[model samples]
Target: MTSQAADRPEQVASRRSKLTREREQEFFDAVLDQIRECGYDAVTMDGVAASTRCSKSTLYRQWKTKPQFVAAALRSNRCPRFAGIDTGSLAEDLREAARAAGGTSDKDQGLLQALGHAVMQDRELQQALREALVDPEINALRDILRRGVERGEVPADHPALEYIPAQMYGVLRARPVIEGEYADSDYLVRFVEAAVLPVLGLT
Candidate 1:
């Protein structure tokens, strides 16, 4: 067999010998906290190694580059905020979604802001951020809207339907920048009731 094929078993064995899930989550948590504190460009593998008390080589073996490491950490940290909301009313579903989004930790928002510049420059980081932070939420929001359409609460051809995710997420991400406060659950629910539901004739 070729050298690469011959090495596959040993590689898999070595990977299987890596840190347990709990230990790896510790590493990921350290990485995210470091990124929040230091910004993406400033966080180093050595810093993560020192903070998490793991050998730098261990990190390098698991993720060869800093971008890859950060991406993996971002993916690991994802918590789907918009899952399993079946309130049977679009307005209520959205309000519940807003409440969930607002309840998310400040560290999440901070990490996205911290990595914003770096993500623009690295395709992998951007993909990771979208996969971890963006896609699941967007998909869930779409599901909510789809359910609304099925229930005849909103028309599928409504122009505003396409922009619901953007509108909600944009405000969620922008509120801290513009207003100097995280958009908490109350604010989000109010916003949805006032701005979003009315537009769809739910109000």
Candidate 2:
């Protein structure tokens, strides 16, 4: 066989990999948008393939099941939104974090709400949700608290330190359930100022 013939298989695989990568985001976006529009149960592999203009077999080739597909999509969209927030003060850092979270709260909360009990049944989906949405912000918030302790703004052993993440996350998830409204930017900022700041003994 000629060298060209020998290399054709490798070239074909490389091109296939590139094509998969290029279409990956399109698939992810379609599934997420569908989840947002219709709850998780309503989002199917066939629906996603139709939305993305790909074959159902193509989706199955990429991910074997709807849960696997959604989990992969969530993992692919991982963005550490609260990373790199430092303002020389824990109060300001938290305020900035609230602003950052509030910016995407509606969409994120909607996804979580849409996923709802479906995530409870699937460990992979649960992990993907936490990795994509929950863990990064919690880690970043803890880092902010650690910096506060180092700066002597808050004592290292302060009782409230451990609960900060819960408090922040709780409010975001709770406000809508309580009042039928999202915890938007202004509401989050005020929460940071009135509730969170006071707990930390900050102005």
Q: Work out the TM-score per prediction.
A: 0.91, 0.91
Best candidate (score: lDDT): 2
Candidate 1 structure quality by residue, lDDT tens digits, 82-107: 99999999989999999999898366
Q: What local lDDT does model 1 show for residue 171?
A: 87
| Residues 100-202 of candidate 2: C-alpha lDDT, one tens digit per residue | 9899999999999999999999999999999998998899999999999999999999899999998999999999899999998889999999988998899
Task: State the weakest 10-residue window (summed lDDT) of model 1.
Answer: 9-18
lDDT of 2 at 95: 93
Q: Lowest summed lDDT over 10 consecutive residues: which window, candidate 2?
A: 13-22
Candidate 1: list runs displaced more than 4 Å. 1-16
Whole-model lDDT per candidate = 0.90, 0.91
Clashing pairs in 1: none
